[model samples]
Structures are given as C-alpha cells and as structure tokens.
Target: MHTTKRLTGAPGIYLLAANALVSTSAYALNTGTDLNLSMKPIAGGMAGAAYTNPQEVSAALFGNPATLTRFKSLHFELGAGLLEPNVDNTQTNDGYSHTSTSAARNYVVPDVAVSGEVLPGFVLAGGIGVDSGIGADYRTSPVNAGAGLGLGGAGAGGAATLPLVLELLSFSGNLGGAWEVTPDLSLGAALTVGFGLGQLGTTGSTTGLQGLSGNFGGTTSSVHNISLRGALGATYKVAPEWTLSTSIKSPLQYDYHSILSTTVNGYEQWQSVKVAQPLEVTWGVATDIVPNLLLEVDVAWKNWSSAALYQDIFQDQFLTMLGGQYTLDAWQFRAGYSYASSLLLNSPNGSLGGLDGVGTLPLNTAVPGVLARNDLTKVVQTTLAPVVWQNTLTVGLGYAFTQHFRLDGFGAYAFSENTSRSTLALGNYQVTASEWAIGAGANFSF
Candidate 1:
C-alpha cells in the first residue's frame, strides 16, 4: 500500500503538463484517426471500444468486416490535428533547497484513407495513419542540496540545469472483406500493418556548480523502427435496427535499432538501445436508435502480460492499461481509464526493458553533487500509483455539407497520475491535455 502524503510531497510542476499530454494521446485510442476508423457519427454513444458495429465506411476495416456488405460504391476520408502541452513543477528535499521548471510545445499530424466494394460479397479497403500521439520538453533551475548529497541526492554531485524531449509516429495500412454468411449475419476479416518513425532530443547544463560542472554539455540523437499488426471481426443482426459485433485486433511486434550520441567532456560517444511492442484486444456492439441515427458501445483489453523484465537491452517492468468508447449519429463521444506499470522505478540502472530498449543510469548520474541528492532514480510500486493511471473524455460532431461530401470535428480532454509509494519520490503527480481533430470526406455510388 502507498500513502497519499508520501506520493504528493514531491513537487514538480512540469510533471502535471507531461501527464496531460499522455492522457490526451491515450484518449486518442478510441476516437482519433489511428483507432477511430473515421466513423465518429456511428461512434457517439458508447466509448469507441466496440468491434461489432461498423456503421461508417472507414470503420469497417477494423470493426466488423461484414459492414462492408452494406456499401454500394467508393468512399474516402482525410484528417489532421494539433496539440499543445504546458507544464509547471518543482522538487525539494530535506534541506532548504529546491528547483522549478515549466515548458510548452505544439505538435501537428495528418491522416488519409479509401475503401470500395469490388464484388457482390467482396470489399477492399486501405488507410494511412499515425499513433502514440504525445511528446514533451522540460527544464529546471535554482539547484538544491538533495540533488547533490542526501537521501534524494544526485550521484553526480552539483547544482545543474536540465531539459528532455521524445516523439513517436506510426504509419499504418489495412485490407479486408465482409462476407454475408447469412442474409442477416455478416463475418469479416482484415490485416493491418503499421510502420513507426521517431526521434529523441535532449539538452542541459551540469556545470556552473561546486564539484561536478566538468563532465558534460548539450547533446542530441535520433532513430527509427517498424511494427506489424493485424485483426479479425464478426457482426450479427438480431433485428432490423440492432446489431451485435466482436473483434480481435492482432498484437503488434516491433524491432527497434537506434544510436545515442552525446557530448561528454566536450567529446562525442555513442550507445544503443532496443525493445519489443505490446499487444491489445477489443470487443463491442451497435444499434440503430432511429433513421440516420446509430449508437455504439465497447469494452477493450490490452495485454501487458507478454511484457517481461529484460529481453535484450530493454526491460519490461510495466503491465497493461484498459479503456472504452461510445458513438451516436452525427456525434461521437469517448472516455477511458487505465493503469500503467513503471519501467523507471524498477530497473537497477534505469536500463531499457526490452530488445532495442535504452537505459537511463548514465543520464541519471549526469547532475552535480548538490542537486544529485534529491534526484529520483526509481519509483516504488503500490496500489495507488501501481506505475501510472490515466483518464480521458472526448467529443466529436459531423455535418453533411452535401449528399456526397461531409465534415467532422473532435475534441478531447485527458488527465493522468503516477503515485508509486508513500515517500516524496513515491507521491502523486498529475497531468492534463486537450486535442482538436477535423476531417472531410466524399462518397459516390455507381
């Protein structure tokens, strides 16, 4: 068990901002382009976790393939977005010393897709999109005593300045079909593939202090990786306006290869890290409330059980997260909650937990003695924080400008907290984030 007081005492404002970005990205799991299937109107009532009802043309690729049988022609969709992150935080130790930092940044992303029926009972569809939609930049000044030589002290020993940043992007594709097994029941199958491109940047000061300013300077690095994924689904019509559905989104496997380049004593050196990706599954249902109005609800499960302690250079100390979604005609709404296990709090040397994963021990030891004492190297696990917990709510609306063209928009708000133990390093920390999405599409029949 973890005490709230111990988890709440460590004051770091930037952490609040970081949690927001993470929550927003997590909410994107049910409504954003990567998982939303561009069918917000049919996804408004229930959380976007359902695999049974594929009301919109775009969603058929991931939900129920049998939904494709309802289409008579060709359809296409496109979307783009922007996100902002802001943070304010401080850290203090047993001594009278402390440090605070705040930062904000913006991110922009885009998506596109198309689908069509090639035969009486056969349909073909494909799309391009992104995922893991979050990142951050943080810095702090006014070095403290715990950061250098005490219970929370930095092993490096000195007054210092710090800044860090990370980004992840995924490009994915889909191909599948909806077969009318019976007049009212349809079965579907699909294959999904996603490729990831990313970069990591860091810059800071370890000098201008008492004993350790001579070890480092500004540094930066970048890398790339790819992942493969797939899924299958089925839907049964119980009545003229009611449908039941279920789907299994195959797990993603990843191979990451990267290099870490930084300046030490003004000289450049390189290191490498690697890790494997986690797997996820979802199931749900949909019903027509009235003409042109549809409702959907879903429940999903993610498998972090396949997660391990150390496969290669990376360590998998964290476990799974859970979420849900709902949709209605012309409007879509979504909400989700999840618990994330911690990798930072478990590794002896802060090493990456899987193949191609990176380590943080060297980076953790980069600070001066005075500021090193209070440096938090590990976050002990407990029920309260159990690593990390995130919650989110999303809203979306769509309008048909014409019979062939339509427009859709979405907004989401999210928050997260990580309280692992009952100490200053084990206390509670929070973050909030918001996102806006807009899309346009056209449908034509032959």
Candidate 2:
C-alpha cells in the first residue's frame, strides 16, 4: 500500500519553489506549436494519442467524449504525473563559448474525472486537468546576465547576475456528452473553459552605472481571464475489431500582460505586453490484430501560425506547425509501446527573431561603437531564447487488482534536438533540449 504525507510550513515553501524552478518553453510536453499532453497514463504511455479506445473514464473528458458510451457502469478516476526536462543552451561568439542548463528538474501535473450513462444511449462526463504547459528556470550565469541586459563586457562584472524564471500554466474544466447513434457509430461534443497564467521574474545586482543600479524585478501585469473553447469528436466501428476516430479543438486565446520593474537613478519604472494561443485537430485509429492484442495510431495538426508563441520567437512565423502523424501504439499483456514524431518547424537561418524594444536602453556615451554593437547583439539573442523540435518514445502498463479496481502507469522519453539562429550581430544562437515523463493513475467502476 502507498502512503500519503502532508507538507507544512517551510517544506511547503520549498516544494513550491522547486515547482517554480521549472521555466516556460516550447520544448515542454504539448507546449508551443504542439500543445497536446496526454492527461492519462495509458494515453501518455501510448505517445499521447489514444482517442479510439474507451479504456478510462477520464479519457472521455479529455479525448473522445463518445468513448464514454463504451462504459456500462459509473466510473471515477484520479491521478497525477511528473515530467522531468533538461535543457541546455550554448552560444559561441568570437570563438568564446558559453554554456548554460535549465535549473528546472521536475513538473507535477494532476487530473480527475467522472462519467456515467445518463440514459439508454447517452453518456455524460466532466473533469478538470492540466492539459499542456511549459516552464524554465535558469541559474545565474555570466552569459545569461550579459545576454539579458545587453551589458556585454561593460564592467569587469557581467550584467546584473541572478536567476531567470518563467512559467505558463493551463488549467481546464470540461463538460461534455456522447450519444451512440447506432450500435457502431457515436458522436460527441464538449465545452472547455480554460484558465491560463503566465509569470516571469528576474533579479540581480548592478555595477557602478549612475542611472541604472541596484535590484531588478518583475511579474505579470494583469491576472489572466478565463477563456472558452469547444471540441467535437466522432468514432466509427468499421469492423468487429477496428475503430476509427477524429477530434477538432477550437483555438484558446488569452490576453497576457506582464510588468518589468527596475530602478533608474533612484526611480522605479514598469512596462507591459500580450500573447495568444492556437487551434488544433487530431485523427486516430485502433484495431485488435489478434485476441487481446491492440494497435493504435494518431495524427495531429496544430495551427501555430496563428499563435503568438512562434511569431514572437521566430522570424518565419508563417509556417504552420505539424505534429507527429506516424505515432504507433501496440498493446499486449496489458502493456503498451509507443513512438511519436516531432512537432517543431525547421526554418531557414535568420528566420527567428526577438520581441521589439525589449531590454532596450539609451546609448551610453562612454562606450565605443564596436562595444555598443556587441552589446546590442547579446541583448537581441537573449530576448529571443531559441526552441527546437523533438521526438519521443513511451512505454505503459495497466493492471487490475480486482473486478472494480485498476492501476495504470507509463514513462516517455523525448530525444534531444538542437536548433540555431543566425543574426547580423549575434552570429549563431543555439539551444538544445531533451525531456521525459512518468505517470500513474487509479480507476474504479461498479
């Protein structure tokens, strides 16, 4: 039996701080252009594409609501997972190489849902979960300080030295119903309300600059508002052993606002900004090749072209992001193996850029043109933190201890990928990232 412990006082603060260390980035599961993380261990173990099989109650709320029709008894489920991602960044300028790694090590995600037949042919379900999100926390480094503040080689000391933190959370509530039109056909729809919060913070010390000195800090300028969206899905039993399904999710848009604070000549100042989300669609099929043996596949497309994440980070913002379509999952002995493709866009050199007017300052008369140019380059490179594509593989297992109780667990590993950006001043900027996840959940039915 597993035991649970409650955290209090300093321990709770440490836990919260540990969670906060994870920064927000596109490399996260279902983050950036490809925003789809499996909410259940079975599906997550199957490469985040398990829409055709109605195996868990929570699947109905997150995947295909129509799958709820497959359940004959009332069902309840609750679970949580941890994701560990390691990101490394390296930049070489004038033959000097600087390397840094993300301080974030673990992310905790949880989910809960309940579903049942409300009538002869209809099923109703509701749930709450963390769908997809990203975060990053980098330790203090000379390179980060130099890049963040455009203070390249200014004082013997680098830019204000401190840790950088960024995080984005997407929490959602879902309500939906599924109807079995006939013995072999089902249709489902759901209304999803999402609440997203984005936070960014930076703190550091400054040198003998007369105007700008002391500590620097910032936070979200405004609280995020709840956003509404919808999803539609359909499943067809083509044969006694074959099932096909498809789902489309509307875009979720949130107006993000943030404030950057700093003291200039004994006076404080602040600035603000906004961002938007994207749309997505998924198609899948599952088949029983042999008795008690199943195979599943899924293809998903994300409309990142319309999202602000890519546009703000890359110059080639017109490219629509396409996710792995060849994801394959095979199940036997209540165990499953999965493979998923990458969801990143490969743009040409110089295709990526940074936000405008971020970290800009009046020219320092004391610095020479050469020094000023170098500093500006570092500033732009820092502002436009780079993101790349990655592929993943997963394994999962499900076990039944009794007629009414079941447990499921899974683990996934994302391959490492490196991407580079070339600019007139910064030369080449590169970032590499790799990730993995583990999750478990329990389901009850009677």
Candidate 3:
C-alpha cells in the first residue's frame, strides 16, 4: 500500500503572506513617509519652509498659503525634479544569506503654481504637484525565491525558481487661497486630490505537489485609485526681524482595486485594498540676524499611528504574527539659507527629510509554526518588502535677471539607511536605501 501526507496548511499560509508582502513592499523607497518630495528647488535643497516670506513666489503654496498675501504682484512659477533611488535587500535563512539590488531608474516629478492679489489683503492661488510617489524594478533571482519559500522547510527548494517583478507610482493635485487678516497675520487653505497606480508580475511553475503553487505562477496584476484631502495654514510676523508659521494636513485615503491575470497558466483573480496618507502638522520660524542674509527652521510631525490603512492591514499581522508594530510616528526638520540683491525678498531657500516610509502591505493568516520554524517573516520583511527611513541635506541658489524674471536651482542628497528585522523562526532581513534629487524653476512676476 502507498500513502502520502498532503501539507495543505503550509502552502496556503505562504501564498497569503506573499500577497500581503507584495502590497506593503511597494511603498518602501527613498522618500520615508509617502511621496512628499519638496517641489521647489530653492526650498527643497535648503530643506526649509518659506512660510514667513511674502516674496517667496508660487512655492509658498506648499507651505503656508497665507504667505501668498506677502506677494505684492502677480506671480507664476514652474519646475520639475529628477529623483534617483537605490534599494538593496538581503535575506537570511538557516544561516544562509543573499542580496539583491533593484534596477536603476529616474523619476521626474513636476510642480506648477500661480498666486495673485484678487482683493486687497487677499491672494488667490492654484497649483498641481506630486503629493507622494515611489517605485522599484527588480529581476528575479533563485536566491530571493529560495528565501521566500524557505519557510516551508528544506523540501521547498523546488518552488524557489520562480521569477518576480514589481512597479509603483502615485501623485496629487492642489487648489487653494490665502488672506491677510492684519499686517502681521494671514490664513490659508487648500484641497488635494490624489492618485496612484501599481503592477506586479511573476513567472514559473504554476503547479506543484499540492495546490499552493498554481495561483500566482505566470501571473500579472495591476492596481489604481483616487483619493482626496485638505490642508490649512497660518503665518504671523511677530517682529520686523522674525516670523512664525504653522500648517495642518488631513489624512488622505484610497481604495485600490487589483486585477490579476495569468496567460500561460490560465488564471485570474480580483482584490480590493485600502491605503492611507497620514495626517501632518508643521511649525516654522524665520529670522534675519544680519544684512542680506536670512535663516529659517521648521519642525514637522506625521501621525502614522493613526494611518488606518497601515494599522488595520500590517499592524495586527506585524504584532500577532511577528510580535512588532508596523506603525510609528515620523518627524522631519529643515533649515534654509538665502542671499539676496536686497534685504531678503530677492533670495533663494532649500529643505530636506527624515523618517518617511510611504507604502502599505496586506495581512495574511497567522501561522505561528510557519513563522517560528523558519525565517519566513525575515524574507517577507527584507526581500519581499521592507521600510527604510532616511536623512537628507540640501542647498539652493536663486537669481533675478530682471524685475519680471527669476530662476532658482537646488541639489540634495539623502543619507543611506540600513534596517534589519530578526525573528527566531527564520533569521534576519536587512535593507539599505538611499537617493539623490535635483530641481530648478523659473518665476515671472507682473
């Protein structure tokens, strides 16, 4: 007589975990939180918020719209950024480790805005920009696949030959206005509309000893969505040499629908998912300590703990399955520098980032044995998807060729960050991330 033991539970758990990992890993790129790239080259390089300056041009729309009241005439600006990022993942199992690097790619982010006094002490402005964005392309490797399937034990080697690929993109649009209540105080508000898209592909054997392997092999999936949110800000000139400003952004959420299809394997599936853009609050101060030079500083916070999309999906799984928290508060700092033809109105500024991991993952069934027996979580955390928080430094310059024409440029470098997660079941998962960005804009004033 012949008999066989079918490990039904193991493959199901692996597939489910793989699905969740795919979604979460898509957002773990250079930006830290989400796609919060600074649109103005001047302010971006200096890592500063141009909140207190009335002569800041259209870039002011990103900080305190109320600063728009500082503009005395019609202003228009346009610019774009070249962002390059490098991501590397290392997975270890049973004391064996392997590293894989993402393919090189350049992302172009655009910015445009206009502001003018529609009424005395009132400014009307509108613009379109990238609120958040990130993506990575990776080639399939036997080592990575082995790491992903190693949780099923040494016998799972046959399944590790599968090839995988991933890509993601997101952006937003804004419209707003500002009003000066008194010579020293101003208020501003804006609405943001968001959009995102993603794709995942894989190739390999569609079937194996049990049913666990047939679903995803030779499959491709795509997801996209739209969302909305709002922002409010205020600025006050406390003294001729000092200014204070603050801004708050509401949470943005999206319901992405994914459609999966396999041609060579003949399979298809559909899924619905939710993503959150955390709430943010910022405070800033600017001062002129000497002549023709200005300095500015800003502190900002992101409420990641309240990001329902991440908490609901990855948090519970991270805690119950991996014994950790998926959500944590994020903070950012920026300092600015400007040299002008005049006291301060003719100068340029810059800004930077820290602690921003801008993506989401899914939830799989909690199988303690699978997690405890091998470094399955490490593979999921490292090779499949990992979050990295980075620090940045930047510099900017601006020149006014004529009263009506001005140009600004900036360059920034983000320090590399290495992150690792360890579990008794598998071993350790580590990832290193870094990036570089450059931007320039032209402004016309009438």
Runs in model 3 lying further than 4 Å from the true structure = 1-32, 35-37, 52-55, 140-166, 200-211, 218-220, 259-268, 312-363, 372-387, 424-426
Q: lDDT (CA) for every model shown?
A: 0.40, 0.54, 0.53
Backbone clash tally (model 2): 11
lDDT tens digits, residue span 1-446, model 2: 11212322221222211111111111111234333545475666666656777567777678777777877578888888898777776655445456666676687888788888889899888888877666656535422333223342333332233345556677889998899999999999988898987655453432322222223233223245578889999999999888888888787766554333322233333433344456667777788756555667666665655555444333322212111222223322233333434334443211112222112132111132223222332232232233344466677777777778878887777677776544332334467877778899988898
Q: Candidate 3 local accuracy as lDDT?
A: 0.53
lDDT digits (tens) for residues 15-44 of candidate 1: 311111111111111001133432233232
TM-score of each: 0.65, 0.75, 0.75
**Order by TM-score, highest first:** 2, 3, 1
Candidate 3 per-residue lDDT over residues 123-173, each given as its tens digit: 888777777666545544422433435433333332233344555566777
Q: With candidate 3 superimposed using the best TM-score fit, by how many Å does residue 365's alpha carbon deviate from the native?
A: 2.8
Q: For residue 28, what is the lDDT in candidate 3?
A: 24
- Overlapping backbone residue pairs in candidate 1 total 73
